[model samples]
Structure formats: C-alpha cells, structure tokens
Target: MKKKYVLLFLIVFMLQHGFSQQMVLKKGTILDALPVQDSIPDTFSLYLPTDFTTEKKWPLLLIFDLEGKEKQALSMFVQAAEDEGYVLAAPRVLDSISLSNSIVKAGKVLSKVVGMLPIHRERIYTAGASSGARFANLVPVFIKDVKGVVSIGSSIANTELLNVKRPFHFIGITNKNDFNFTEILAAKKVLDRFRFPNQVLLHEEQTEWPNIGYLKKSLQLFTLAAMAKGFAVRDSSYIEKALREDIIKVNRLKNAQKLLLAERYLGEMMSIYGAHKNLDSLRQIQKNIRKDQRYRTMRRAENAALFKESLLKEDYQYYIEEDVITHNFNNLGWWNYQKSEIDKFISGNNIYEKEMGNRLLGYINALTEDNIDIVKSEALIDEDALALLYMLKTILEPQNFDFYLETISLSSKNEDFGTALFYLEEALKNGFKDSDKLYGLEGTALLRITPKFNALVEKYLKDARYEIIEE
Candidate 1:
C-alpha cells in the first residue's frame, strides 16, 4: 500500500512539472490571414511561448518586431509571462508598411488569431524594438483592451494616440558608445513633453560584437523590468538562468575600457547641455555623483533642455560603468523647458514658437474657407495664435505641404473658400517651396470663390472685363 501511494505521488509530481502551471503561450501555429486556399505569405509568422494550453484562458502580449530568430528573447518573455499567468503571442508585423499601419492590420489579425485560442481579451499587451517599437506603441491605439506596453532598444512617441489613462512603460537599451546618444536625448526631451515614464539603460561593457553577450543580457533584464512594472510579476522562476547570466555579464561585470567608454559618453552629454551652470538640479546630480569627482564641469547658459539632456546622458553613462549604481533615469532633472516655451509663446517673445503656431493655424484657416454662399465653420485654431503656426509651417516644415493642404481641404469642407485661400497666400508669401502644390491649391480655392473665378475667366475671354491673377 505504501509503494502504491509513492508511485501515485510521483505520477502527480511528473504531471505538475510537465504541464507547467506557469502562464505562458506556448504552441504557435502559422495563422494565415489571407483567404482559405491562399498561399502562405512571408509576412505572417506567429510564435507561441512555452505555457500555452487550450484548457485555460490566458492573457497575451503581442510582439511586433522584424523577423529575427529571437528565440532566446522570446523564451525569457515567455517565462516571465508564464510566471505572471499571461501568454505571449508575438506576430511578425507584416513588413508591407510602417509599424503603425501594420499594427492596424495586425489588430484584425490579432482578433482572428486570439478568437481561435483560449485567450481572454481583457489583458492584451505589446512590445517591440526599432520599427517594432513604433508598432507596439500604436497597438493600443488600434486595438482595444490592451493593458500596457513594453518598448526595448527604441522609443515610442505620439502619446496622443495611446489610451492616456492607461499606464505606459518604456525601456530603451543602448551601448555606452552609441553614436545616436544625441538623438536619444532629443527623443527623451519629446517624451518629457508628453509626460511619459521612461528609462534608458546604457550598456557599459565593451566586449565588442563577438564578446558582447552582456548586451543581450541587459536587454533581457530590461524586458523583465518592464514586465515587472506592466504585469506585476515578482519571482525568480520568471527569469531563466540564461537571462540572469546575461544580466550579470553586462551589468554586474565591468572592465576598464567599458569604464572609459562610460566617461566619454558622460562628457559628451555634459558638454552639450553645460549642466554645471545650473545650481539646484545639477547640484543634486552632483550630490549623487560625489564619488565620481571628475564629472564636475563649469556651468554654461540657462538652457534647461540642454542641461537636462546632459545630466541624463552623463548619469546613464555612469550607470553603464557601474551597474551596481542605479539612478532615476526617467527624471529629466525637474527642469521646465516646455513651460519656458509656453511662457515665450504667451509673451510673444520666442520667435520660433510664434512662427510655428502661426503657420499651423494659418494653414488651418486657409484650408477651411470656401465660397461666399457656403461658409465653412471656423476651425479650432485661434486666428491670432495661428499666424505663427503658419509662418513656421510654411518656412520650416515644407515637407508638411501635403498634410497642410489636407487639413485645409477638411477645414474648407466643414467651413469656407476665403479662409482656405488666405492660408494658401500665407504659405506662398512665407517661402512655400512647393510651387506646384501652391498653384493647385490656389486654383482649387479660386474655383470656389465668390463671383466664380472660372465663370469670370470665361466672361473675360469674351468681354475682357476681368484679369486673371498669375504668380
């Protein structure tokens, strides 16, 4: 009887271990979105993590990166998901267009795929790198019921599209010597403007390409870190050994060359911002880095944007050298750059800000005006403020002509022709580079003006009473 009891206990143990109670989506089948009998497309590849099963309703995380055998990365995410009782269903965001566009299409495909699985619709999430980050950022915009997102190795912007009330966690992983540090700083500034919580982890170890297993490790921890915040997982079982080793190699283990790399990165950041000039925030950063005496530098002008950039960049570099030291990389040093811009805008003292606003509004007004008999409604733009938007839009962002034209068209449809013509004239007067577009818009607006420009043209050809305006 004792032997029988032992055998039963062993059988149950084996079952429990084999059928991991961990929550992960395992078993991925190629879910073709094309019609039945259609050939398989290269754009659609689905990966299921290890814990997927048909019996239980699982939460899902859709990864939207390019096709690389991220088998290890996917495995770590799966382990974390399983530990947190969630499923990971990463679809290769079809490469046909931008990640945002692909995400829109993926939303439909996601619904179809999840419908066939035992997935609960309430807790969907997304994460990606590079182009994938853009798609992951947009997933919540196009898909409903997503709880959060995790972005690795890149950043997400256009926060307006996101469910603002929902939590957004961003993690960026880059090397200490990365040339895009300035670009990364700029992106951080933009995110600060939008008030999103983000962290940048700069890898300090210099193993070169072949020796840099630490880079992968840092990325995995970043994934885990985001998973912890977004999904609320807290257990070692979620992080496999491979992940832990990688994290230790890059973060815990540091060498002299890596330390030098960290210093150079910090110096570059400090030089850009002249943070040593700021008293309070820079002082606080100094207090934190007291041990690293060499980081001290002379202060420069009162440029908070430059200062914040310098501080974050330098601190990130420090963290890279000494993984043991951790700092709030999310803090943009409590500087109010946006407020300063707003103040200048309010005071009408900042020329660039004034112009940008005027150009935008002017373009809006111009696009909205139509014929005298059918006046389109006034646009949301404040006429006085929009002059600057128009000035900047026409001069600085010439690439926006098409978009400006579209906005004008929509405004005209909803409102009048006169206003649209005014914007066209403003754009033209302010060095609008695209003459072809200007002529087309001008012609369209004139066609709908009072007294009928087309009719007048015909009458003028016969009676010579009206003269056409030529540019």
Candidate 2:
C-alpha cells in the first residue's frame, strides 16, 4: 500500500509540472494572444513586472483597447506597471463587438488571471483611453472586485448605471483640446454627488494618451488610496516621495503664473494626501490662490467659455441635424464660414477662447463622425447625406485626405462624376498626392481613368497612374 501511494504522488507531480510547462510566461515582457481558457475562443495580452513572483499578491490593471490593439495598449501601461510593481493585462475586447459581449469577455479574462496569478482581489483596477476608457469606466459596474479606474480622454460611459454603494476610485486624465474635457468635468460633479472618490488630471495635448509620468501618477494614486483604506500596508517613503513631487509641481505652476492650474493641483493634492497626512498648509495655499484677482478673473473667463461652448455646441447640433436631413448642399458655404470663425477663436490671444476653439473643433469632428456612423448603420443607407458629411469633414479637417477620398468614392458610386471629379481636384489642391490610392479608390474605376482625374493627378503629384487615350 505504501509503494502504491508513492507512485500516485509521483504521477500527480508530473501532471502539475507538465501543465506549468505549457505556459512558460516570462516576467518583464508582454505575452500576446494567451488564451483565457482552453474552451473559450477569447485571448488576452499580459505583462508581468520584472520583479513579479508568485510569492506575494500584486495589483492588477486590466486595460482595454476598443480598437482591438491589445498589445499596443499593454505597452502603454508596461513602464508604469513595472515601476509601480503591478501586473497589466489587456483583453481582446473591441468596439466592433457588442458592449455586453465585451463586458462578458473582460470578466472572463479577469477571472482567468485571478485564478492563475497572485492577484490581490482588492487591488484590481481597469484603464483605457477614449472609447476604451469609456468601456473601462463601465467594467466596475458589471464586474465585481474592480477597485478603481484610470480613464484617459473620456468620462463615465453611463452615469445612470452607477451604484453609490459600490463606488470605485475614479482617476480621469484629459486635455483641454479633447472634446471630452468638459464632459469629464461635468461627470466629476456627478461623481461628487454620489460621494465617490475621484480625481481629474489635465495634460497639455489633444485627444491622445497622457504622458507616461501621468500614467505612473495614476497608479500611485491607486496605491495611496489602497493604503488610506487599509487595503495595503502604508509605505512612508513612497507617500513622502509622491507628496514632494506634487508640491514641486505646484510650486512650478505657481511660479509660471498659472494660478488656476496651480490651485487645481493644490486641491487635488489636498484630497489625495489629506487622509495620509495633514494638508492645512496646502489647503490655505489653494484658498489664497482662489482669492487672487487674476485667478478669479481667469475662473470667470473659463466659466464664460464653458457657457458659450454649450450654446455653440447646441447650435452645431441643430444645424447638423437639419442639414443632414435636408441634404442641404447649399449650407456647405455656411459650414465653411463657421470654420473660419472657429479659426479666429483658436488664434485669438485669449487662452480660454483658444482652448474652447480647440474643443469645438474636436467636438464638431466627433459629431460629424457620429452622424456618419448613424447614417451608415441604418437599414437603408443615405448616400447623399454621407457625401455631404464627408465633404463637411474635409472642410473641418482640410489636411485629412481620407474624407476627400471618401467623398470622391461615394460620388463615383452614385455616378455623379461631376461631384467626384470636383472632390478629386479639391483633394489634390489640399496636397493629397496619393495617385495610387486615387487610382485604386472603390467605385472609381472609370473616374480614375478620366482625363480630368489624370490631369489633376499629373498637376499636383506629377504622375498619373493611367493615361487617357484621346479618341
């Protein structure tokens, strides 16, 4: 009986060893397309810190890339995850899939990771940018154990779905030029009403990922929150280091005469460190800054800009709807004139107006894209509406060659060669020199070979793919 038991133990050991060998993941590297489960078709990309080991539980940041760039998304957080000693995982969820299905897949990936890794149940968080950020904000709603979210370039996906009892730490990072900037500020008010712990970080770029330093700061905020709540042990050195860094930033902002930004940072610092340490001094500084005449004036200007932006956005919404429904090609000139007015605001000396102008530009483009998607997704497509939107897109973003090409293709599809040829020449005038793409544009076989098309291509690009044979 002893001999038989020894043999059974040996067999069990071998089976366990074989299973481990099948997934020999390396730390400090990103592993792509790892299956969530043997039976499930979904896969996830993962990154383990260089010091990662099964000896202790580590925080896990589940990242989402709605465009399906899992590895790319993982790379953005890898440096911060490594420095912060956190595990990063990005599932293959995409915007192309239904939100419900994406949530199910993300839940499965989270479950699989928790089962396989030493993930701290209380330290799990979600993060993403833009649409992905919006999706990440929804993860805590559907999936339990999500302690926080690091949402970049967006706000909550649906405020109505939020449960106050299950509040998570929300860290939002956005820029003035991002169309979602004002929306995020408004969402902060909602979060405040729900009594949810939240912070909004502003960066100085258009709609894109925040600096990697901001990424690190976001994870640091999560760590601080964990310590404050007793979810993790307090590290005096870490907390002091973060506090010093923030104070230095505040001083720098103050020195630069950016009182509004300085006050905002000071307020954020007070919230973050208030539980960990005394913040009376920081609170006083914020109070003083707010009382300053220049700061108060700046605040008023910002509020005025916000109010004007809302009215302008409403006007844009109404005009766009009316134009799209009427297929009002006559309103194109009006749209062009509005672009000029926006340009004036952008170039004006008023910083608030400049920021508002950038936001409006981004908002209009997003609005146009949304309408285009809506029209295309309908059971019966409206080619005329699409063509108009595409033309408007070109006007809004003149350097964007894709919309010009799209307009040309749609016109060609409808056998509107005059419109097609007109856009083709316009595209060339706007420095679109892709003769190959023009030649290969869908529904433009005959259009591309036309004398006008070749002449325009030859005029701008100095080369035409096809020669029109004169009869």
Candidate 3:
C-alpha cells in the first residue's frame, strides 16, 4: 500500500518538476539509454528535435520495438520524427513479460513522457514493426488521443474495430517480398471499403526492416493527415513539395520501363494525396497509364499471382501449425519440396511469379523466426520444438551458419554431445569456414574438447584450436 503511494507521489513529482533537471540529452542525437528517472526506472529511448522546447506543445510518436532493440529502432524512427518536429519515444520491453503486461508498462512510460513534456493532445501517434506494428495499431482502439498509426511490416491489428466515425490515419509501409505483403495490401483494401484514411507504401525486395525513406514518407503521411483533419495548420507549400516528389518517383519508375510499378505507385498517390493536393496532374498520369495495355495485362497478372501466393501462404501456415504440434520433423521433406517449387518460380520467365516465389521464402522464414522466438520464450520452454526449428533452419537456409552453430550450442548446453557432434559436422559440411570463431563459441567447452569435434575441425581446417588426443 505504501509502495503504491510512493509510485503515485513520484509520478506527481515528475509531472510537476520533470523539466527542472537540465535537459542534457542532445537534440539531434538519439538518447539510446533509459531516461534518468528518480523513481521507477522504465527503459525508454527518446529523440528530441534540435529546436525542441517545453514552451510549446509538440506531436509525439511512441515507437514499440518488441525485441528490445531500443537503439536500432530509435535510430530508424528518429530521423522522420525529427524532420517533422515530433518527439519520438521507444521503450525496451522484455520477452519474459506477457503482451498485456508489456502494453501496460508501455502505457506507464508514455504517461511519464506526457508528464515530462508538452505534448499535442490531438496529435499523439504510435508506430512499430511486426508484432509491435500490430500493437501500435491496436493502441488507439483502447487509448485516447492517438490520431494515427505508422505500421511497418504489418496490417491493422483489427479491421472489425475500425469505426469511420472515429478513425485514425493509418500508414502501412512494407516490402514486396515481406511475409505480410499480401496481408498489408488486403488491410488497405478493407480500409478503402470503410473509407478510412489509409495509405500502403510498398518497397522493393525482401528486408527485415524498411529503408528510412519509407519511414520518412510514413511520417510525412501523419503530417499531411494532421493538416487535412485540421489538427495542425495546413501548409500549401509543404503539400505541393510532397506532391511533386511523389510525381517524380512515379516518373522515375515509368522511365525505367516499370509501367506496372508506375501505375500502382500513381494509384497509391491518388489515394493518399488526391483530396489534399490538386489531383488534376495525378489523374492525368493515371489516364495515360490506363491507355497502356501492358499495364492492364500486368494488373491482371498481379491479381492472379496474388491468388497463388495466398494459397501457398495458407499451406505454409496450416502445415507449420500442425508440424509444431506433432513435431513432424519427417514433414521437413514436404517443406523442402515447397521450397523447390518456390525456387522454380524464383527462376521462372514471368517476373510476377519470381517475385511471388521470393515473397513465399520471406514469409516462411519470418514465420519460422517468429515461432523460434515464441518457443524460446515459452513459460514451459519447448527445447524440442526449438531444436526442430534450428534443424529446419539448417535445411531452409543451408548457407546461414548461425543456425548450425546455435543448434550445436543448444545441444552442448543440454550435455547431448551426440546431437552436438552431428550438428557440428553439419555446420562444417555446410561450408562454415570460420574455425577460430567456432572454437571461440561460448558454452561449447564440452563439445569443443571431444575427439570427434576435433577430427571434424581438423579435417575442415588443419589449424584446429584443440589438439587431437588418443586415450
């Protein structure tokens, strides 16, 4: 009971006297560490613009990076928020905490931020990637005053909860080969049907993270939304500049003979900027694009490709779920066969099929990693499921040496040298050449000294760190 009052008193003190301390954190630089809290130390990363001051209220962007990668995420989001004169806050949540618990902790950190700074009540926003992205979208559903969401690598948390009467601007940024690519697009379609203010930004290729520019564009979307909704004053010059940049990007795609890309890009611009900026020029580009049979054919082809991608994704999800439950290591052959099919499409004559194939690979890997995180972090840890994932990782990505080493380490830690030895051999066979790093791996001391391990290492590279011995 006393602890509760102490917490409350600390909160009150921070609310009343947060700015009394010298604001030593540099303006442009990302303070990747936790704030100096006088009471409870909640881990959070913050970025204040160079011109930041407590005199005026500022828009705030609360970023949630579920993996506790505060520094990297802060760096990724800082530029966009700084450019748009918004404060960015990213909290460090642990894997041990339940989702609900983390959300509550995040709320506490946000409250501390609100207490410390003068935040524009109407312009509070949230952004994140993967599960964090989904969570960011879900925030406004439960909390008040979140005017928008910038979700990278995901769709909205729930479409059913979307109310046109109280809608928040949604900006989705994803890569073409992302596992969530189709889902993100579908989310946009659902938002479109609801007449929800939303825009989907798709980038080229597969990447775990979006390029900073996509994020910058996403931040710009919020700025535009604030102006459009009268949360902030409208800036005609800024709108025109943004529209001009969008046109140049479209032209660049078209000039590169990427007419299909240009068409889609223009369509997205129309959705995002048609109402705010003068649409006569953008509509002109769309009219010209409609005249091209090449683009028309490509659109149909893309739809067909999407249908195929959806089926394969469903297959992956279904089989993976079943496999996780049954520990169907034998069904790895089926997964391998699916990979072969994906490879065929990757090398196919049609560009759409190739992209779809890459998307499948990306989707599978992402799901695999997510499952690994789940199993590794489970309350009753499923060591077998984790071992299975590491084994599957060796098969799915033969060249990625980390999985083999990790499997070996897990086996060694469990004092199962037979399993350890097998994976050690597999790692060497897979062309992992860094012997010193292998010898230097921590928690593999027992495995490292085995004659079998030494033999494998010596055979691969004569300079084995441990000498071979005969008993």
How far residue 251's Cα lies from its native spot in candidate 1, in Å, is: 7.4
Q: What is the lDDT of residue 392 in candidate 2?
A: 98
Given candidate 1, what's the lDDT at residue 311?
Answer: 60
Deviation (Å) of 249 in candidate 3: 1.8
lDDT at residue 195 of model 3 (Cα atoms): 81
* Candidate achieving higher TM-score, 1 or 3: 3
**Which ten residues in a row are the worst by lDDT in model 1?**
4-13
Give candidate 1's TM-score: 0.39
RMSD per model, one decimal: 17.2, 6.0, 6.7
lDDT of 3 by residue, 328-413 (tens): 87888998888889899999998888889888888888789989988977789887788788877887798999998888888888
Model 3 bad stretches (over 4 Å): 1-26, 32-37, 53-55, 158-165, 277-281, 347-349, 373-384, 409-422, 433-451, 463-471
lDDT (tens digit, per residue) of candidate 1 on 306-345:
4543564454344322321222222222212322433454
lDDT at 292 for candidate 3?
88
Q: What C-alpha lDDT, on a 0 to 100 scale, does residue 52 get in candidate 1?
A: 50
Top candidate, metric lDDT: 2
Candidate with maximal TM-score:
2
